[model samples]
Target: MDHIFRASRQWERIQNRYITEDAAVDLTNLKSDPRNFKLSLWDPTTNGVRYLKTLAYHLGMELSPAELARIRRTPNREIGDPTTVRCGGETLCMDYLQATYEVGFIEREIDLSGARILEIGAGYGRTCHMIMSNHDISGYCIVDLKNTLRLSKAYLRQVLDEPRFKLIDFIEVDSLQDDSLRSERFDLCINIHSMTEMSPETVRAYLDLINETCSAFYVKNPVGKYIDKSLDGYLQGQEAVEMALENGPLRQLLDIHDSQAVQAAVPAFIEGYRPGDAWDCVGDSRALPWSYLWQALYKNPRKPSDG
Candidate 1:
């Protein structure tokens, strides 16, 4: 949280200096700031964190307790601040975006009261923030790597008034390791678009973990095949018509199970359309990245094994 809070501050400064500044002010003035120099030039919306955190990460510097405390006490002035989010250029109310994304994808409104749920890859505790702000799920744990856990804990403290809803639990063993998350289980386990950034091998392990951990789980962004190394900057570009088609690793796995969509995008899977069919799933109608909200559920009836 402290990291995110600090990152948020740095991000706002970036917006103020670069995005909002006029041409008269020398951009060199902006260059002098150590924080700005640290960020690798990726836009704020894409990376989430600002240059400070990246600098600390690269330099292997840890914030002292006093500095951490100061960051923790940093006013939550940006809590309700309006900013344009990455998705659809929507002017999202921070307080409501979390709740709305869940509601939109969950296919139902949430009532977490007395419900125990676990969210994998819970970045910045947005899901926890949304759930807590809206409903009363018993309590959810923000389980991630140690660094993310620490960062998210500080974020919750800064922005959230009652940060009781999220428990900061760091997974010691690798999240992809089978034995790591096997013993723990919950009512609902979720992996939103978060898994998109994971390595291909880890993605399989993540899916396996979710399948084993909870009776019912939600997996959005199930199409992982088109993520090509060459498409790094061009995946969403208009040159796909001329570029040689490549399948991402996830598609191979899904294809074996006959779940892979012949088309690059996933609406084909939902609409039961195949490649080269009379209708195309790739052209003008395609929604890159956010087109289909794949909500797969695992439902296994309880066996008669005596309780």
Candidate 2:
């Protein structure tokens, strides 16, 4: 299988260099051979935009002038809760990524029950709701910028009314070092799509803080060898991550590292999900199903001091 995969890659290079125009059209005739289709999909040189458009058209998604306008105005903000948002034309809904990992977490039974969970980028508290709703757990806390914290508090209050769930709360702090934040500790820390919002220095600082104060941590982010320039929010380079990790404070706290596939949350498609003050645009925000969710866990090796 290794040799076959390698040879397949080599043939793709040849096709990209020598054959351009009729390659896709010709390949359709070769559909009987599954490897040919796989090779085409894997070809880096193939234009993904064209490919995706072709796929969408084949799936019978037609856009009228009004629908196209709706898509155009659809704000690209994070959907903390998909159930509340209206999907104008997208085929999939929320819970796609959440459900997959829920089963995985359950099978693993990794002891999330009643843990003092912390989610870094608790945008509108959707992921927070996932943890609190699904797992058998104790309490969860959210740390976010003042703007997001305000929006999340409002959203949660409107959407839910249950007593047992008081285990969840929101905190507003400037930097993690704000006297209020530094004085506290949590059992687990989570960072969803929030890492990209900060500078490398801030990421390292936050990681160090988590290491010193928290017992365990989880992060789901995009990292690896290949850099896809076309991604909507892909990192410019890997150095930001490297610099953060190499800095001493982050190095000591984390024990294990795991990389999981996260769907890149495309804000362009979501209605009402915007960069503006979401609180001000409550009824008017456009949102699309954002696919970015990664889960990485860290175990605190040294016992935290009982201060």
Candidate 3:
């Protein structure tokens, strides 16, 4: 039963920080915090922003001044108390801009019109909002840890109108069972960088769920391994544990898995796991360093063994 669906210590720290800052005017400006630079669209390096802008243009956003103005008009930039900067003649938050690019990533492969989608980690509902804005999807669901779930709820409530908001479901991660997931089948399931923060078992459980029902899925995560580090910035693994014993920070390794563990779940033998006609799946360059688009398939529903 997910064995409590344990999250790695690092993610626990991140969620706890969000919970702790639930009241504080949150830091959306990249320059506000050094730690924000990693693991979140809430912050992006200068080059990352540049790449995002370039991607957006390629996706056809900035082809004209009106298009740029339209992008600037999107609510993601300032909604939910995020700080934004001026870029390419538009005021933007890297988080919001990054979300736009992600929605575009999925749209090119699948038609989101009336799609019933599920997102594993909806960071403050950024991508959810972006998807709803760009498409006329029937519904959306977000399953995540408690802290992040709360954040998404608060943000989505304000951004999405009553009808659209009511169509959405927010489930806690632990509540999604193996045998019975949601009442209705989903069209697509998405998981961004959050899986890199999950324990391997947790990641597989989610994949198993998607395998059971979703028509398709999209994933963007770090390239290899789910090596967790402590909040104090000490890497956690067998090597880390050894360091702890040998006069290191005394932080022991946590139960985690290498990236290959996930690859095992989605075997290349399965057509659903295959890359698009011309898409380069090993896209460490676009998402982030050592990060890649692991898989985005018009899923075939069941694994080969299900036959």
State the RMSD for candidate 2: 15.8
lDDT of 2 by residue, 1-307 (tens): 4544344676767667645556656755464343454545544345554544444443224344433333333232234433222334453223323333432332242366656666777777655655554456667777788998988777665544465347677776674444555666776666755664466566666766676567655554433212334442336466754554443212222212222221222122121111122211112111122223324444554644111
What's the lDDT for residue 125 in model 3?
Answer: 82
Q: After aligning candidate 1 to the native by TM-score, how far in Å is the CA of 250 from where it should be? A: 2.3
Order the candidate numbers by TM-score, best to worst.
3, 1, 2
Model 3, 145-226: lDDT tens per residue? 9988998999888887887789899999777666657355887788776765665456557766776667667776533333
How many pairs collide in each candidate, listed in order? Answer: 7, 18, 1
CA shift at 50, candidate 3, in angstroms?
A: 13
Which 10-residue span in candidate 1 carries the lowest summed lDDT? 273-282
Top-TM-score structure, candidate number: 3
TM-score of structure candidate 2? 0.48
* Candidate 1, lDDT over the whole model: 0.45
* Candidates' C-alpha lDDT: 0.45, 0.47, 0.59
lDDT string for model 1 (176-279, tens) is: 45477678766666665555555545555655665556544554444534433332456567466223223222443233123335344454333321211222
